[model samples]
Target: MPVDKTSYLLVDGENIDATLGNSILGRRPHPDERPRWDRLLAFTQERWAQPAKGLFFLNASTGLPMAFVQALRALGYVPVPLSGSAEDKVVDIAIQRTLEALGERDDDVMLVSHDGDFLEAITPLMDGQRRVGLIAFEEFRNSGFHDLVRQGMEFFDLEHDTRVFNAPLPRLRIIPIEEFDPQQFL
Candidate 1:
């Protein structure tokens, strides 16, 4: 796998946000704070040695904030919104379809997600000529798709690379209880 080849990065936004925000960052899911997209894009481009074309798949029913969507676009990602129905598997389906379409191309393919549902799409891509890999959290080492690693899928753990992906943690301010005035409540 030559690093010079272009890589198409397909991201499952909701799945990643949950893992990064709650599991890694110790923040509530979908908190106002967000990962630094610009830094992440730059890091990936530098590490891979070619500009990665980013496609971010999110659920529309989750009420994606416009500011976030704008931010994604500003950072050079195409936002693909899927319906937010309980039975909706649009995001997974879209990711699979895109992978299949790009598998025929010469560029590399990277799936940025921890969901094992993507294994179906990832398996065939691995057998193809183009290089295929996965970017996920370290927690997924125990996930169902862990076998993909043994099958030669390149896995990049975002947890180990927090400089690029972490959202800013909220600062805590400390005050002496004795100095606190009950009148302040009024």
Candidate 2:
């Protein structure tokens, strides 16, 4: 089917996992600690006020994580499994190309990652013509995204902004005075 004016939710599973482990948690997350993929799709639809199509990219050079892939499929996401040489960053390269291609299409995109490698592809697409958003943990997002925010690209905190997780994560971010509600801590 022709996906005209469709919102594309491109997920970089590798980047998300790395950042979650290295930056956010400082350890590997348990199965239940991970973001719920279904809620992510639901959140994007409500936030964008448009139906979204999820495209989850994963590197399959070693082998496919069949359970995870099947889970994503059950939730309506297309698992884009790519494989290449051991040295290749298969997922990042594929998503970069996908982002570049989306630049020519009229689709709105919300990319899930904290990797800075995508900045080049994300820049040109930030023009006001279509909605371009970055979804990542706020404190861990690539610094380059600040410039994109100034250029009108929307940035959404995966947990805080999207409320896409089933359980609250152990994240410590500076809460702006006005936006801070005591009830959260209470």
Candidate 3:
């Protein structure tokens, strides 16, 4: 029997947290500054016009953060806790393998990350067939991904496009003329 084709929403939790803390916020984010995972799922479903299966990948080598994992589960995310030696990039490896496996399925994929490590994994997936999207703050995204836009890869701003966070993010991105509002400066 054929199963339903659901959009796969893959999240790189570590990359996002690191980028937010080190680059965007200049420190660890408060609870309110975190993206609302529910909104991301909703955006994926609506954008692709299909049910989205949200998978959040995290490094669990140091032990699982049960509270965060439980919260993710409550918000409809499947927490993929991966463990490995101190030198291993466990989460990235797991996500890459998952992406490779997805090649056999007809499901659309939306990857939430700014890391360039997945470039090789996602490059072949955009063979002018299955829909693939990247969710990240534009200014922080890898320049390699910016090239993918020409190859029909859909790029979205996590904060502006998805409106996933309760609090505004400090992103220095060029706004499209249509979205420019001068009143904020006054």
When summed lDDT is taken over every stretch of 10 residues in candidate 2, the lowest stretch is 2-11
- Listed per model in order, the count of residue pairs whose N, CA or C atoms clash below 3 Å is 0, 0, 0
Give the candidate order by descending lDDT: 3, 2, 1
Clashing pairs in 3: none
TM-score of each: 0.75, 0.94, 0.96
lDDT tens digits, residues 160-184, model 1? 4535545544323233697677784
lDDT of 1 at 30: 54
At residue 139, what lDDT does model 2 achieve? Answer: 90
lDDT of 2 by residue, 57-149 (tens): 999998999999999999989999999998889898999999999988888999999999999988988878899999999898889999898
For residue 11, model 2's alpha carbon misses the true position, in angstroms, by 0.4
Note the residue pairs that clash in candidate 2: none
Pick by lDDT: 2 or 3, better one: 3
lDDT of each: 0.72, 0.90, 0.91
User: Which is better, 1 or 2, measured by TM-score?
Assistant: 2
Among all candidates shown, the one with the greatest TM-score: 3
TM-score of 3: 0.96
